[model samples]
Target: MHTLLKNLKVEINDKLYVKDPESSDLGKRILSCSIEMIYELGFEQFTFKKLGLAIKSNESSIYRYFENKHKLLLYLTSWYWSWLEYQLVLQTLTLSVPKDKLNRAVEILTQEVTQDSNFSHIDEVLLNKIIISEYSKSYLTKEVDIENKEGYFAVYKRLVLRLKDMIKEVDPAYAFPASLSSMVIQGALHQHFLKDHFTAITDCNSTTTPTSYFLNLIDQLIISNGKK
Candidate 1:
């Protein structure tokens, strides 16, 4: 799978960036440094000037790739989801059993991310950390509806729809497949955040991860619904 993915490009929306970061050495450097800087400084504190220094390039050069920090965040989040969608498809595509496929989908969506050597320029693990912590900032804005119309969140919505389809396959009568799908994706991020900072409020820890919680949730919700 890694070999297959090495040649695969996780395409993001063209509107997300001024230039394709994967096209040039400097462009790739911009993405690599931006991910590191955003993970280290937090998005609110991350700046073009800071990323420029990290990559030893001018701030304007960074702008050639991304218009501003918010656009950059949008690009990053979009890339993460596109990559994750690849994983979900590759991992679950072969299962003949509906429930088994759904279970694997839940596990992939909820489990903590690990580094992928196929894409060396971006650290998916750090990107996942950013998603868990700062993903809301990408869309929690007045422009969200406008951006949604522009298809800025297309990859994410597509991912949710994939899970929704999987849920429907398990229980065609399930009325809330869309809700459950989005909840598992969004709830996994929330639970990871809670486990990291608000430990007192969540039961998820190193062993009892969000993956386990959501897996059990699917069993109860979809499986039980099927039995009924």
Candidate 2:
């Protein structure tokens, strides 16, 4: 078994090493490499040995950053959430009105699904698999649920809350819950991603872009609900 260190200065057999930004970069590299490998090969087939080969880094270097594969997965999840928050902030800042800001947020999310090369082609399938699996596990394990309750869900939650507030301003009698509004927004944004199997069952045009559908849906929802 590997021995644990107590402080920033890790001592192994009278040797001391200081962790720095380079170490952090190394950790990120390892996480990125692991994500790529997991995308190429399913998680069950992904291994540290394979990841090291893909990144051209030694396993010992990776171990210095992460204790095991599970820890690496957690790190990847955190990285995704952090990057998503940054994206949302950048998108939200471009608009002045709350309604426009929420609209832009939906547009950004939809555009991300189609335009982001990270989620394009085969990588998209891999990512969807990983997201579905992680979400299910998080739901069951209570770790992610706990994190959400503790305010780690602030970015996404705040985006929804802002949208709900806008809806309220437009119409006080809007009866739908914020959660339902958020889901509808997300569903509208993800329609393209879900179109493959859905096409056979529905007559809706698949040619429409996610951003267009999202904005149209938001406008219609607001107009219809405001009259009630």
Best by TM-score: 1
- Candidate 2's residue-wise lDDT over 142-192, tens digit each? 476765565544544555675576566556666774965577545643454
What is candidate 2's local distance difference test score? 0.53
Which parts of model 1 are misplaced by more than 4 Å?
A: none
Please give, for residues 183-203, the per-residue lDDT of candidate 1 as tens digits: 999999999999999999999
Worst 10 residues of 2 by lDDT: 7-16
The superposed Cα distance between candidate 1 and the true structure at residue 208, in angstroms, equals: 0.7
Q: How many clashes does the backbone of model 1 have?
A: 0
Alpha carbon deviation, residue 54, candidate 2 (Å)? 2.0
Instruction: Output the TM-score of candidate 2.
Output: 0.61
How well does each candidate superpose onto the true structure, as a TM-score? 0.98, 0.61
RMSD of each: 1.2, 9.9
TM-score of 1: 0.98
| lDDT score, candidate 2, position 112 | 39
